[model samples]
Target: MAHEELNRQVRQDLRVTDRTSHRRLREQGSTSREDLDAVLRAGFVCHLGVIVDNAPMVVPTVYGVDFVSRTLYLHGSVASRSLVRAPESTVCVTVTHIDGLVLARSVFEHGVNYRSAMVYGVPRLLTHRTDRRGLLTGLRVLTEHCAPGQWEYARRPSAKELAATTVLALPLDEASVKLRSGPPDDGDGPDAQLGLWAGVLPLRTVWDDPEPDPALTAGVRVPPHVSGRGHRTAP
Candidate 1:
């Protein structure tokens, strides 16, 4: 399906509850589902926050989104069930992209230009015995999201590998999206008379040239999908 049609299928608005309500900087908060989708689509990495052993734990992981289903697929660990052990537990997944540094004349006004999204839900774990298709689909979505066309170019997971892997699906129904961009907000404030330079220092991440392994076979060549990513900005 076309990207536009997929987006049309997504819920139009985000569900705002007490947890998602912005108490500060309400102007930065967003209720549009498209804003949330944009934040998620702009990055492949996310931080999964959940309670482990009665203690709060936050783990960094890669994620992919299924806009049609409004699902977020996350990579998990089979060894550490902190993510999937408790079937009834809720989790929070957050994805953020830092666009630049907002430099203001005053220290107190210094800020960051970023886009962030936080999703809260009870994750549904996909396992071989339970939902094999979902497991593979989630993994494929994750792999492609990180590196387009790599899933088909690389070896797929075997039955044994699939059994040892863990993947979670979380609904994007309840999420909070926030975006901060442009120049410093103190431009018209009292600090304007300070005569100090104030502007935004933009940041960008790009993919470098593909590095081949020392042990790579002599006949092997870098695929177009891999080599073409060189110098391209990352999502």
Candidate 2:
């Protein structure tokens, strides 16, 4: 999407009702749909929050977004009570990645710096066939974001399978993004003289070699995307 469109979407989505002292929290935040989309695209897993039986339930699931439609799609088993109850309730979806572990001279100053995005919205059930198709496309985009070739090589969902799944679409509004990076903020004092190993140990997500199904034909070769899988530093 265009940068201007992303800025507009962020303005519409982020509602700032409070203030804080941290410069990172106050200034380095964004609500842009593009920013959210980038965050979503960088990772496939998201934590979904909803109320079930008057209690809060947070579940982890895969998510995808449609930039043109401004819709986010989530799917799970039709028999999942959480999925059934979530559509009617307010939901918060969060995606985060830990970039590194910050080791400081002082134990109190140690922290894990990371990037994260949170989305708050009400979900609607995807009932129309056309809408469902769009959602499925979004799903494909999500699953194959890193490995572009997998969407075509993998088995596609059938009509019967689609019918047995529950997919929800939530508008990309009322969200926030916060990120922190770099070394610990240990002041120049006694702790600085401790001479401890203080720096960052980077973290990364790597894809392992793809193992084919044992019952499959022996001559099949792994798809390019799958065979060439590599590690990427999360956000």
Candidate 3:
């Protein structure tokens, strides 16, 4: 009951509103906050859609999620034009995980099995004069988002490096998640009699054996978490 209550509360807290509302193909939409969280946690990279010079720009960058604050953090260069323009305007951040290829009898019916989330908000830029802790937290999330156990194993960033980086946090209050995963829709349709091949070919991202830095000292070995994901699909 406790878990149920928490889920209910999260749902209420993250209820989708206008603008973030799903329209066409509503069957592929999910209102569950848990689903949104899962999509965000599955990937570290996100395409940040913003307007620069009155033109649309979609910049691919690393991201981190602060579920506690209902925020998504984006990392970019301090001098990046898109990053500079983002804070001044409402930006859209999209994260997607492709699960498989959905092959159908008809080409028009073919699609991809994917989980995607789109979030819109005004971003908060973290700087030395602003929220330094937010930057640190964002970096931590970015590191852990890419691969768990890496943050602990890696060297910490220095002041100069932090100064060169920009962290932008966008609230997750307005977002939409759309996903599709299943056998092809044509499986039982008129095309079924065509006897064409139809099914899902799953795809996975995995960590291969670690390649040490060329400058590393001899005798070092791969860590457990690094090696444990052998042939294992990475989130």
Candidate 4:
């Protein structure tokens, strides 16, 4: 019940700022925190947009979210310049899931069905030596986000390995959420008289059967967490 109330409060209108305000496609924009969480939970990969060396750089990386703390965790190699420099200035993290292609009678009316979220903030870097606990937590969240149960099932990272990793925590205080779904809008327009077959081509992601490494022992069986994942649809 407490969580429910907290959710209700968070679901209220999100704090809108110049960066988060919707200037166009106002109909598809959402200010509800629930909408933002849905967009983040639907995918693990995100594009981190930041300025590196005075040039705009976009890096694709895996991410995880902790709603309780209202933070987004992103990880990468410590040697990566983009990750290192991201803390120097504000950054934008975007996650998008393409649901379908909206086929319309007219070319101008054609569009795509997608759910997207953009978060803007100045992230704080978590170094393994200085912030081991924070780094581990971030890594676990990231690993589990990509492959549920893998973090506990697999061996934990060693000190050297952790030292080479870079983790960034970005607050979820400011964001923009937009979702577009359903059929083409030209159905009731003049283009409707064209009699063209216009509809949505839906897309889905699913996990395939797991393949074992060649060096693995033949008698070893697949873990339940993994074997059960096969043929399952991804969010």
Cα distance off (Å), candidate 1, residue 128 = 0.8
The local distance difference test score of model 2 is 0.69
lDDT by residue (1-235, candidate 4, tens digit) is 9999988886676889999999999999999988899989988999998877778878888899887899899975431456564446788999999999998998999999999999998888887876899999999888888888899899999999988888888999999999999999988889999878999999999899999999998799999989998999887
lDDT of 2 at 54: 75
- How many clashes would you count in candidate 2? 1
TM-score of each: 0.92, 0.80, 0.89, 0.92
For every candidate structure, what is the RMSD over all alpha carbons to the true structure, in angstroms? Answer: 3.9, 4.3, 2.7, 2.8
Which of 2 and 3 is the better model by lDDT? Answer: 3
Please report the TM-score between candidate 3 and the true structure: 0.89
Stretches of candidate 3 exceeding 4 Å from the true structure: 1-13, 78-86
Residue 194 local lDDT, model 1: 88
Least well predicted 10-residue stretch by lDDT in candidate 1? 77-86
Model 4 lDDT at residue 38: 90
RMSD in angstroms between candidate 2 and the native structure over all alpha carbons: 4.3
Per-residue CA lDDT of model 3 for 105-218, tens digit only, reads 999999999999999878888765577888889888777777679889989888898887778878888888999989889876799999778899999898677778899789
Error of 2 at 5 (Å): 12
The 0-to-1 C-alpha lDDT of every candidate, in the order given, reads 0.88, 0.69, 0.82, 0.87
> Once model 2 is optimally superposed onto the true structure by TM-score, how far is the C-alpha of residue 152 displaced, in angstroms?
2.4
